[model samples]
Target: MTEQRKDILDMLAAGKITAEEAEQLIAALERDQAPAAAGLDARPKGKVKYLRVVVDATDNGEPSRVNVRVPLQLLRAGVRLAALVPPQALVKANASLSDSGVPIDLTQLKPEQLEALVEHLDDVTVEVDSPDATVRVFCE
Candidate 1:
């Protein structure tokens, strides 16, 4: 029905191209356009707003799945809130986190840094596959 498809059929009708050749051309055209047609939600890479974690596993021989979508705006807001906390409280929180093996400095959390981190996350995707479980982490 498309112009290119019509052209291919016309070529076949005129005997300029064989039926097989016309079929191949139509198939190639569909393949080339499939991604663009299917990607209805395509967005700019820099505009990634959610951090997604998806897990599928067999638990006790029963299949289970987990899908989590966390908005990047929530993290940005948390970072902004951290700025209002007293320095003494931040130090205590940092120490507690370190004691718990987190090793993160709460005082170092800045909104700009979080934004930059989220932007970089757009380019990162992590996948873990095993017989029992599969995990995927990406930005969307």
Candidate 2:
């Protein structure tokens, strides 16, 4: 449990707050911290550590546009295959991603899910600059 969670529990145990209050506190904490790193594979696959994934997409002659907090593993895989995508193979590639753990939910992905995602992605790199908690996918 996080220090904040422990503190919340302790407060409830001491009757400083009611159970409902404790639950609400915990939920508040989660929500406040959720959006910044919310995504499957946000952390290193299989670990509870906090992380974030950002996706940068570019179209013909256009500058890149980014989607933040994308699933680290899924985006890792997608970028790899997307670079060499044969137009008709996108669906198959995404299905393969489903096998890895990209979780259609997009909130978080288990390690197994990340592994599943990796298996389907043809070529991609997952880089972690820990201080930043961001994963950058280079589609080539």
Candidate 3:
């Protein structure tokens, strides 16, 4: 348990606060600490330590599986580093991505926006399945 949580419980045990108040205080504390705790992978419940991508498929009647775990911090750092790229390079990259049918524009990817997106990704799970293969992306 975190010190904040422990303190809240202690107060409750001492009748310094009612059970309902303690519950509210704990919930508030958890909410406030969620982002930092998630980044550090310190919380047990709903904490994502890695970005995982899994693929399972059959090729010519043979089965194959690929599993990958990437640290979320790496992605955050990459996004922040993108700000250092030359504008011309970003423009070219954006054009290439558009040509490849990925409609995203790299020039518009700000670090702050990426940080927000990554934070939101903690609760996101994506899966795609077809007759011969399945792909899954999630945080864990």
Which candidate number has the best TM-score?
3
In the range 1-140, model 2's lDDT, one tens digit per residue, is 88999999999999999999999999999998787667643744533222244644445656454544444465556645545545456566566678997535332335456656555443445775553244475332
Tens-digit per-residue lDDT, 47-116, candidate 3 = 6879999999999999999999999998888777877899999888889988999989777777798889
Model 1 agreement with the true structure over 46-106: per-residue lDDT tens digits: 6788989999999999999999999988867776776688989989999999999999987
Of the pair 1 and 3, which is ahead by lDDT? 3
lDDT of 3 at 36: 78
Q: What count of clashes does model 2 give? A: 7
Clashing residue pairs for model 2: 40-108, 40-109, 80-123, 100-113, 100-116, 100-117, 101-113
Number of the top-ranking candidate, with lDDT as the measure? 3
lDDT of 1: 0.87
Model 1 off-target regions past 4 Å? Answer: 1-46
Provide the TM-score for each candidate, comma-separated: 0.55, 0.31, 0.64
